[model samples]
Target chain A: MEALIEEPGTADTTWESRLEAKALIPGTSTGVAFKLWVGGLLLVLLVGIVAYVNQYNNGLYVTGMRDRISWGIYIAAFVFFAGISMAGTLMSAILRITRATWRTPITRVAEAITVMGLITAGVFVIVDMGQPLRLYQMYLNGNWQSPLMWDMMAITVYLTSSVVYLLVPMIPDLAFFRDRLPGRVPHVQSWMYGTLSFGWIENPPQRRALAKAVAILTVLIIPVAVSVHTVLSFVFSTTVRVSWNSTSFGFFFVAGAIFSGVAVLIIVFAIVRRRYHLEEYITERQFTYLGYLLAAMSMIMIYTNATEFITKGFKASDDDLFAFRELFATKFAPLFWFYFFGGLVLPVLIVAFKRTRTITGLVVASSFAVVAMFIERYFIVVAGMSVPLMPYEPSSYMPTATEWAIVAGGFALFMLFLTLFTRLFPIVAIWEMKEEHETRVEVAP
Target chain B: MIVDLRHCDGCQSQGTAPQCTLATIEGHLLPEPMEWIEVYESPLEGGGTQFVPTPCQQCQNPPCVNVCPVAATFSAPEGVVLIDQDRCIGCRMCMAACPYDRRFFNWGSPPVPPEALLADYSMEHQVQAKVGTVTKCDFCVDMVRAGSLPHCVAGCPQGAIYYGDLEEDLATNGKTLVSFKDFTTNNNAYRLKEELGTHPRVWYIPGHGEAVGRDPHTTGRMPTKWPWIERAKGAVTWKR
Candidate 1:
């Protein structure tokens, strides 16, 4: 039994110590680069806040959204962020369940993104509404049959579980920060660590309890995550619009979630790796592995796009033809082609080629995927609405300056969350990586 | 439910729309600015033209009601769909879901006329005069409850629009009352986009721009005037 344990203690312990010594060290201060990045985001966010205030005061009239195009960039951004958030559960829980060894160092980055993404996604939905306070009215006078109600319920469930999923793994790490960082940072932050750590002493019983909780939560969150993505797509599919009323939408959206989720995961991974200089933890192998995932996702996305087009193109309802023409031939052609070529095609080519499978290539590819997926969401919503359900002339939806400012604010807020998260806590899951090493080492209890 | 296209030539002769839209806005003082009925001039395939006057289909399975998160829009017991502007959170999901494009939103202050001030608000006779909410053709629910034809049915100058009690099998175009089943069957009336299973109660009796002396090549449409612009000098009103 002892011999069956695969711990070569010397090699394993040295690696474990290295991870502990370097990876756990917080960036010394808000460095000039960090300050500049945050300051820029803050400026954008402030501008956006002003725009949002103006929208509230002046009514939705400040935006270009007419009755014809009721939804605009805010709803689009909601879908984009909601889909991107799946990276957390996808990277952490699903990969953990599958027992992927290489996912350990990068899971925290994914989970942090999930938290930030889900929150910002919800924020955009509020922004889209004529009255943000009506969100509560929806809950109070809830309609069981409304897809919007279902969407709200699904988001609440998913968000709760995601927060738990994010926090559970961070407990021991929080305790670590609590014990290690108080002397180094300000008193208020130190107090925060102490309060959140929940006295995690890491005794065998406590450790077992947390492990059990994490395991249960991991199993619990997958369906919830799937539901969040599906329900959002349902908001469109359930509508009577010919282009959106397809049965294939749920599966298509889930695929899109994974595609964008993995793309964002790679981009975040690259930034963390570069900024923290944790080359050893986030390896070239990680890039290669993610490249394979990205390629598969690109293929799936392209296939879904093609299927959506072919199925609609074959019958060619007048509405379908009009939308298809707009999507493929005219107004939206530039955006459609850019996403097809730059987001889908370029990503596939980059990931498939060994030379371009480097971290830089992966980052570039993921950037295209992220931006294009955002546009895809925008296209799906605006294009769907752009076609007047009646024979009335088709009206165009262009985002107003206010809308653009709010969108920029949303992006800045998301980055601000990640930035603040990294400043206070280790961006990598410290305890989990150590645990993995310990199990491999088979050290004495 | 049947529009007899053979007898109807959209408003080519009348010089105005099925005027129920004017009646609705003036009657309800609604802020949603909904035209209870709308007229469309669609080009026909054989180099002719057609007239499509859309009313609230009052679908058996309403997409608007189901998508409204707050139950702001709902179907009444008699099958006419309605919106409660008071309860509406202004999410506009109802607007998005209505395939007929019958729904309208109050983006800002609804322009109200002096006459509409002090109008009692009800779900059926809405002054949705609220700043942010959805409103649509309610099938003149208030008027029907008062034992009257829908405003549109009464207002159409050419007597083209019809109102009916489907359950009772009676209908009227203001001038003549007839059997709902007989009139539809005789006219070969069909619901718009019946393939979608919306089961819209409003039926088209078919027209090739011929009724009211329509000219297919003319491409003329009824001009929609908001009606209040002709107010007698200094009519007192409420704004907000």
Candidate 2:
């Protein structure tokens, strides 16, 4: 609702001048709004920690999960955050690889998002464990056959690669900040920037090496990101539970990750742009392009859902039918409907229709997509686990207040990381801003 | 083990009273929903019914062992699937992978007697259950290694549940010792959910629970109890 204030979309100022001035200048914007946002996040974080501590004392007995339904909201949140993390890196990689010149404004923002997304997502995996301290055993006695190991490997690879990918593009910017921000920034920060700058002399060979490293990294990240989500999907699909066992799972998960990833990136984009007043650089065209991508992903999700239902339903496996019935018509029908309509149908309409492709409309649609995708994951985990394998009584999981508190903590941490990320470094891609600045000076005298 | 449901009843023997569930509870002091061995009502094609004395199938390709992330559950040389409680992180992925749903997690500190806690913990025997780790029927492997019949097999009054050595081609049901190969082949015994390709260790000759005195019209699933844990006193868990 705060974003309802209209943007000066076609602001008369050109991007080059604005980019040179504001791009390298670090934001120190703190007001009632920023204070309130951080306060709310900290309060939620505190509450979440207290709730988690209580759960640690009582065991998972305090949660809604039981023997019948083992996994719950924590695992689902892990998947959601993993999917969102997959978005920024892949899209940025795809854009870079495909030579999309207009990606200059938000590439750095996307990479930062990927970093936070993976960190938060990885934390959820540990939180889900009943014996988190025994996590090191996974290193010493890891089973190669288990899908969980594949996920661990994929995430480890992806997180490291993402950090590198994020760092690669920032070198030139680090040098820019090192040179430009000495008077503007605190002495320690200036020193830190100089240390991170890596002694880039801007010679042709050095620039060429940086570009080559970036090009290689951009190409390398997509597959790792894709594999991370695909491997995560295997954790569910590898099980003999017919509801979870499906051939289409890999494709479905990868596609869903990208779809949800785009939605999250859009949300992040809106927040960063509006908060920092980057209207001159971010522009309406960038939103429309992302909107189009979102529209396409929405269609793919609908298709994936259809394919899953058709193949799984037609098999006539009792477990599958029971699970499908549980999701489509029984206790989980409302969530299923919301995922189908609110997630897929509404997003498609919002993005496809030309007049509604405005920033506000896209933001609204993106919010719906994010929430609905989360619900979709919740349904897959909870509803799939609800049906009994041996035809005993069907069991249900209703997350306790403790689970809700932990979930709230996860979200608050996500927002907190994102809020702090913008402050720690230049949110704008400084190297690109410098490029534009030099080019403008060359053209206009 | 092969359970011949045709001859077995769900309850303890009338005179001796040593059914598997009771013996297991007495030995391990397992909490609620942790009956290592249980009886389920397996309905028949006809109007009649029978009780299946269900225990861990101990599959050669055990899904529980294969899916455990930390390798907590490992296959014993004697073909028993044993869980290493010391290494178990209690992720519960194995529980989901199990088609038979035989695995159980210790929700909290399990109720055990002071005498029970004094015994040394053994991965081979699962003597000391942990709060968050998973446990299940280990086929009484230690007892088997000690050259004795499992508590359930020796206790069934009808001599229905048979313990066998497949490599040795011998099986016994307390009163009767028969050829392991011939007993299954002759009786048309089959493994449960044969389509799953688990290559299970246990086989069954299916029937209604009638052999154990179940009335087809009235009886359904055989009742299971967790004597150690009290029923929910307040907020009830909705178990189907």
Candidate 3:
């Protein structure tokens, strides 16, 4: 264990330490359960592909979207995925910048979530397009004045920078896998690790360079993440719709993104910790700390929700009255209340109590949060569109089977990417954990 | 364009659908639920209803044009907001941005008359309707270029609609010609949603159907129709 924890430049590391590190590498000895899980995800992905083909063959008429309610669950899913992508910025970048020692075990999971969430979010945007093939026009005739162009540019930059952020800290770990698991794994896997490791010898100069790169990225990613969500909010706020027109929209959306992001991170952490037998690294202490975050975010969400509603409801213009009716008492009331009580309030209560603050309790709270945030996004899109733009009656929308299938596919794709990432790379940052361990040992009297 | 709401009875007295809506639909070969020029009966503040013949506002500061990611929809030099369906990606950002709800989407293949398929397509006269793109009232720029009134202005039985050139300072509703400035000033004309600063070219002289001797309590108008004898193959229609 001592030899394994030592700097990678040390030549005296024993074969036994390599074998112990090798256990962290998944897919070497695949279990039936893992195979079954992957197979199921792929099967769902296949169904989604078939449904999307049908939607393509037909036009957007197959979906629930119509003239008045031109957007639907697809846009909601896009916002949901984009919102959860804040996980990496919060857990990896912000935590790293702040020197939060306990974040080592979960950074890999959070960063992977960010990348996969963004990729799936991008897919939904394409799926929502009536002329998916004409998407190139966005680049060729792109209007810099459009909020959507800003969104496209922001997401692209965020995705590219996040991939770099995820990969930079993993260089040493990839090098470890490259050297230790060469013949043990497939040649393609071995080659990938070797190529991705970028010829790391882990000398002092290389360490200094890697540290500097990570420090720069760690500082840069937070603003990028915030800007991505803020720009997304501008897509709605810039419009003239009564429900969407708000000066507070940018800040409100960022708060919501981080709220949903932390909830998803907690959920992913719990699953990864149990599934990978990482109890030693991801302890109850991490869960407790994240629970506090979840609780705090829930409070922020409540406050923002109140501010948005109270400000609008107090004014009660003819348009505002109709919008309030639709959200609070009419067609969308059930969804709105579900999100308000079950998604926001219940999580706070779970974390506030001592007995239910255990890992199981927090996971339950987080699950609610995840489902509720999705509902919140749904209402935001659907209810905002439901507000009658004209004097005519408000239009309604319900997701068709095709939309539901495609949404399922998006989620499956997200899970599949995350699952494949875990099989290929260590979900835990081994080097970071080693560094944390070393620091703790040195600090001990 | 000026819509004289005082004379507009929504074609109630004429005992037909709003002539403006019918004429524009027939002229453009528009599909079902796409009334390019719709007659909306809105409630007045004091008591009863008023018939507002609403077409595209032709805003100088068009919100739809501002939000279009591809610049597919743009304000022509004529100050009419026109959509190039060929270039539109059908993201519907413009549709959402349109305050009037005048914009319509061809969700599926639009069911146009077979003859409409033969007409050469242009932004000034949107024909050969494309699937997955937005369409709206183009203010009959094609007819205007030919030195003729728009179908809606010419078709109004009560001469309630007017076509005019602001630069020329002249206006006409087929039978009668008037000075544009004098007509607007005398009638106290106002544009819809002027608070939004869209600076719409279409003006309304607000009133119930009082001048045409139709009661405000007579609320409903005849439902508009597409009047297609034969729709193109594999074409479909959907609700707004």
Candidate 4:
């Protein structure tokens, strides 16, 4: 394994250090952990399936949703997953556009999260839809003018762009795996990886072509990311519903998405970095830098939330006031406060304070922020709907066992994708790291 | 339709003997302003409430029609807005678009009894009420299409609501059939928000003698009948 990693054509010192890092941990045994993880994931999935079956047999009645609170956990899960997926696109686009050197070590991890998050995001939409099978008919006979259509279009574009972005960087690594670890992996894996390499003879033309595709996809993903969040906001804002009827909803949603996305990336990257024994590749500096980035986003997120709440509160329209009261003074008050302080303020404060700027502290803060963002999405969706328009109290929502099971299943699904991805390919973008080493003259991790 | 603002003394004192009021299909008699026909205060050209009793406009180019993604809402050939409940996605896009906010979403199972659900539902009429679909003043298309006056038209004791055929240039308030054009022109009749270009089929002969200016606090509901509904105030109102 050492000899394979330190092959002559690979970049010299960095590859040697990474090989040493891998030796520190017993390789091959992770497959056991993978098995356990997969088993747990399947259990979660089965539980969720049972709950969903119940919901289907009965009506949405099993859920707490009333007419006043039409949206709830499903929409929150959708937003959380969508927000997390933006990490890949934003990171890839930033790295590609600026031609950043140090991004190589973390780009693959980020991109894989994006793909998994997006798949779950798509699934969340189905869970939210009262009529899931009819979701296809949304395509067959869609209203182009509806914001829901725009959401469909943007998410599709984002998914396509992320897959292409992931693939462009995987070509050389697939070739490496094909040649280096033949019998260790399954035959089907070998054939798929071999085919994915597109017959790369380790030649200059193939590298150039792959690089060009990567560059194009990187650039293409940014607008798609922005569009997805914007269209999502439109789904709520296009309505006359007072609280959601703001023009600033797009910017607010996008800022929140990016903030949450960055936090998820930080947490996922930390986990993979530790598990893969890639300490030498992903340095402490990366965490600190990402820490600073997360802090900036947290501040921006705070600003966006303040903007949305203050302006709407001033209007005092019956519906808007009712919405605000529900979120701030009623059933959602605790969650709303928790999201604002725990999700936004605390993370920002921890990163800002000198004492908590260490790598471990940053990781803990990032994880907290991710959880808080999910809470925030839930409050925004469910609480927003809690305000009834007529002479009535807004509806109340409670997720049944089925809803809880599905949510757990979604988390397990995310972990499962990440687990499968790391086992099959180099968690780090090896070729990009090589290029960075050759060009940047940065110190070896 | 005309609303005599002078006569409406706001929501009449609860104990006041009711002169006029609106009753729902369920036989719940509400105050005058709460009637199927609403009298709104309008901007006065000079002075006095420009009382307008708004019934279902039965619009020719209804704003509601353009917003229904599933074609759930369509105008009858005779010019009435109708909803095909079965086809509605419960998205409520039309409810948001209507300037008058006339549409209502059935957020949960309607309060109606199970026996009422046995009737057939059609695009021409709404009978079987479903949970999660929208309902509104459908201009009683089912009745009008059957060569009859709408329920509200027949229910109005003041002859306040007029059903009409624009193509035949005729209209009737059940008591009087008048030439649509001459009646409108002679009465200085108008549709609400003419500049919005909604092309409403319902026309009104403005009343109130001129006390115009919308009182923000005064909703259209007026004082009216039924001791039982008032006595049963604490009972849960149906979701519909």
Candidate 5:
């Protein structure tokens, strides 16, 4: 773990450790925690691979999918991951837009999560497709009239913009990594950092150009993220299906996604801070701000849910009545109420209270909110499709082992991506933290 | 021409082979009918149980077609609604769009014993069915393509359930045939729910005289050879 934070001026002991490393084991906490995290992720990935193979062999029958319930776990997971992605970009953009001084420590990590989250979300879509190999068909023979095409366009654009947004902020950091690391690491590694540094030498002109680019990107990414989820909602909302036909669906989906996204960010950042012992860098103030954000999002989520249900419940036609009864009083009632109370309402109360304002308390509330968001997504999908339109008895669907496996795999993939990410780059934005400190000291002077 | 329900007896003798005008595999036609062409005991401004022989509407602007993503259910250029099983994803979007609740998806491979597979599979006539796809009345497209009247049309002794060319403006039941427009106007015939604009090809003429409120099951024997109709009853199990 000591290697995780390299001591720059230490001499003559670096190359010697590599020779004695075989005999002597390093006792770094970062190394042990990282290994354990990577191992857990691998287990999940294995489950996913097995599930995907089964799906290929047995077709979509492995899922809780019937003709009426054509989409199930895969689509919901895609929506969940996409919602998480919205947090990183939106939170970063908000901070940048407001010119928040305290946003320094968390911004780059959030952007990293954003890029990774969107990529995985896109992967889930392919996994859900009946013909993954023929996925190009959608682009080749895509119907412009269909809302799915709109989703494709929006997600692709968002993914590209997010990668650029993430990388643009890292140019200065890559230069730091290049100079700070010992020489003779690798020619390619040196070349990569050297090239990406764009000849940046901490000059005023260079700093101004990098800052200007990041500011512009931050401004651009907010609308693009909003567009991604709004268009995703359009895939269902544009359909004539009774449950999905509401005008409020787009905003409702977006709000839920943002709420969940912030929750995930809190959890991930908390773990990273704890594992890396980044207490000095990431102070308690960060937790307080995140708690405030969570409280705000929880309120918004509660408002959206009430609006959707109240409006839908008011116009109690036969279809509407059946849908409402299914969600509020029948099989999905438990999940629905759990998401409402535990996911949104409880989290809001905890965050708003004076007693539970600590980092641990906020983490606990945010975790519940994220978990609740997942349950909410599941209920939305299952309840909406489970209601029978005809006078016939409604069909019952239960996801098989294969479906469960893929869901496990998706979560595994998320952890794997994040774990790999930390090893390759700094979890906290090193240059930004230094800059924030420098600026503060200069102001005081 | 209008089916003169008063003069027409329930015994339909003019039907072609494998076709029954008054009775079907499910039930028999009776004077107080309980058959496909059943008369409803509806309170009219005039009051009576009306006899109406219902068949596949063969709509021009079919609702089922518009909602099908896979284009499985579609209207032919000649305006007969049909289902192509090969292309169907079994998504049941067509079943949801159909207001009449006429479409059915095969829950299990249609119960044709192995011997039936000896017959060829044709889009014109679905001889063997696979499970997990939709089925519905195809307006007897097979007979229409062969230049013969539909089985239901030939079976009707009362000159009900006509096969017609909407393009040619001609219609024929076995007993009586007439120009489509002239007969429609002369008989005060009307399509069901014309306001919905489905553009249904099937027209109904109100029952007359003794044929009203007749139960066909009391008078006729239900056919047993075609087991496919018996399986259609299984579709009714999907109700909430």
Candidate 6:
């Protein structure tokens, strides 16, 4: 086993080659820790399935949702997951478009997060439905005019493009795995690598073709990602609810999605960097740059929130007053305040200060941002529904045990996808990193 | 339909629960917490409470119909918004879009009497309500077609609810027939949330139960009941 491990920097005599063997180590080996982690995820998934079965049998009444506050944690989780997906695709696309050399190490991780996040997001919509079996009707009897229909179309297009975006750039890496580790890996793993590589030889023509594909996708995915979040916000904005009836919701939701997405990316970078022993590859520079992005988004979110509230409050109608009271002073106040201060403001403070600008600090700030964004989505769905439509007293909603279990399941599924993908494929784009290192070495002399 | 608020004492003078709501529930075999024609006791501007019996407005430009993803809910040719439960995916976008809070969902197998299952299902009547679909006051289009008054109009002891045809220019409150245009114009009738552009067909004549010989200060009305749920087998009920 020790003899099978290649020496650092042997192949290319560069720092990029030093991490190449280390990057493939996770894909080649299965430790007890990895198995235990997967076991835990499967257990949570089982529990979620049980809860969903109960909900399926007994109807949506198994959850705390009712006629008045019809939506709950499921819709919120859908929004949160969907929001987090944006950062991965958007970051990869933008960084690639700008020719950012530092992006090479983390682009693969970002794309994986986008795919898994979107799959989980789509699942939550099904879990939230009262009639899951009727989902096919969305395709068969779809109303093109509805915002939800538009969201369905947008998500499908985005998911397809995202998968292509993630896969197309990794063909050379797959060919590397096929050539280097044939006898060491299992038959199915070897087969997957060979079949997916599409006979890549990394010649100039193949490289040019890959570059053009990546270039087109990088440009195309931005508008698709932007449209996805905007259409999602339209699901709320097009409604007649006082809090949801805003023209600026399209821009607000896009900003919020990117904010949460960047935070998630930072957190994932820290975990993958530490756990996979790739510190030399994924350095503090990535965290610092991503932290700046998180802070910038936090500030934009603050501006959007202030603009939405001030403009709505300036001409407070009777319904708008009730909505304001519910969000600011009444039932939803605690979550709203926590999301504002703990989630948005604290992250900015952490990133802004020189003392707390370390990797660990960025991770903590990102964790806060992630949790805060989820709370924001929750209150947006619940509190928006809480405002009384008529003169009657406001309605209330508290997610049931089943709801919590299902949500936990969604997170577990996302982790499982990342975990399994890391085992099967290289997490880093090795060829891109090597290319970047070669260019840097030529410039140095 | 026209609801004369001046005559609506919320069935208080009759010493019972709001008869309009009760009759609709019985007539439709609706589940608990689904008052199709609910009587809301709203606080007056000066200092009093008034009962406003609200049914579905049957809007000509309904937000609910516009936002249904599967086109399961649609506006009828007669301007009534109806939901086809068989086609509904139960996404509840319609419920979110309705400003009147009039729509109801069958969260569980709704506790309807067994006899309701025997009746043929129709979009107009919504009999044998299915689980996980939306339902609301469909304006009793079937009864109106049959040359009979809606259950709410007939059940109102004060004759406050008038079922009408704007195309025909006529309306009746089970006691007297009148020109729909003349009655609305003369009584200063108004629709709810006119600025929302829903163009609601239901109209209201504002007052505080004065025509029914009741003081505006009377606040509470009897809570609605699902009297048939006691005999409903294999069905469940949930709170709103």
Best by TM-score: 6
Model 1 per-residue lDDT tens digits across residues A169-286? 8888888778766566789888887888888999999989998999999898999999889988999999988778788888888888889999998988888787777898899988
User: Interface RMSD for each candidate model?
Assistant: 3.9, 2.0, 0.8, 4.8, 6.0, 0.7
User: How displaced is residue B93 in candidate 3, in Å?
Assistant: 1.0
lDDT of 5 by residue, A1-445 (tens): 3455445564356432322221111111235666887888898899889888877655554566655555676777888888888877866887768877676777767878887888888878877755456555455544455456678788989989988887777887767656654363456666776787777788999889888998888888888888888988876665545777689888988888888888888888788777655665567888788888889988987887778778878877778888888878887888888888888888888888889988888889988998888887776766666665433356766677888888888888887887766655545566666676767778996
Model 1, span B1-240: residue lDDT tens: 444555455556766654656666666664433565777667788886777778778999888888889888888998989888778888888877888888777776666766666678888877636666777788877787788877666666777777777889987787887898888888778988788788998887877646567667877667666677444233222211
Encode model 4's per-residue lDDT on B1-240: one tens digit a residue: 322343233333232322323434333222111233444445455543344545556666676676555566777676678876766666555654565545555433334444444556675545544545666666666676678776656655555556776778888878888888887888787776576677776665655422333343433334344344343322223321
Q: Estimate each model's TM-score.
A: 0.93, 0.93, 0.96, 0.78, 0.74, 0.98
Candidate with the larger lDDT of 3 and 6: 6
A328-420 in candidate 6: lDDT tens per residue?
898888899999999999999999998999999999999999999999999989888988888787778999999999999999999999888
Would you list the C-alpha lDDT of every candidate in the order shown?
Answer: 0.81, 0.80, 0.87, 0.68, 0.65, 0.91
Candidate 5 true-interface contact recovery: 0.01
What is the alpha-carbon lDDT of model 4 when measured against the actual structure?
0.68
Which 10-residue window in model 2 chain A sums to the lowest lDDT? Answer: A1-10
Return the candidate ranking by lDDT, descending. Answer: 6, 3, 1, 2, 4, 5
After aligning candidate 5 to the native by TM-score, how far in Å is the CA of A121 from where it should be? 2.0
| Model 4 lDDT at residue A67 | 41
lDDT of 6 by residue, B1-240 (tens): 999999999988999999999999999999988999999999999998999999999998999989999999999898789999999989898888999999999998788788997999999999999888999999999999998999999999999999888999999999999899999999999999999999999999999789989899988999998898889997688888
Clashes of each: 13, 7, 0, 15, 23, 0
Report how far residue B20 has shifted in candidate 1, in Å: 2.6
Q: After superposition, how far is residue B16 of candidate 2 from its true place, in Å?
A: 13
lDDT of 3 by residue, B1-240 (tens): 888899999898888999999888888888778888888888988767899999999999999999999999998987889999988988888877888898999887788776886899998889867888999999989889999889899889999998899999888999899888999999999999989988999999988879989888878888876677355566587888
Query: How far does residue B151 in candidate 1 sit from its true spot (Å)?
Result: 2.5
Off by over 4 Å in 3: A1-23
Which is better, 3 or 6, measured by TM-score?
6
- The local lDDT score (0 to 100) that residue B158 gets in candidate 4 is 53
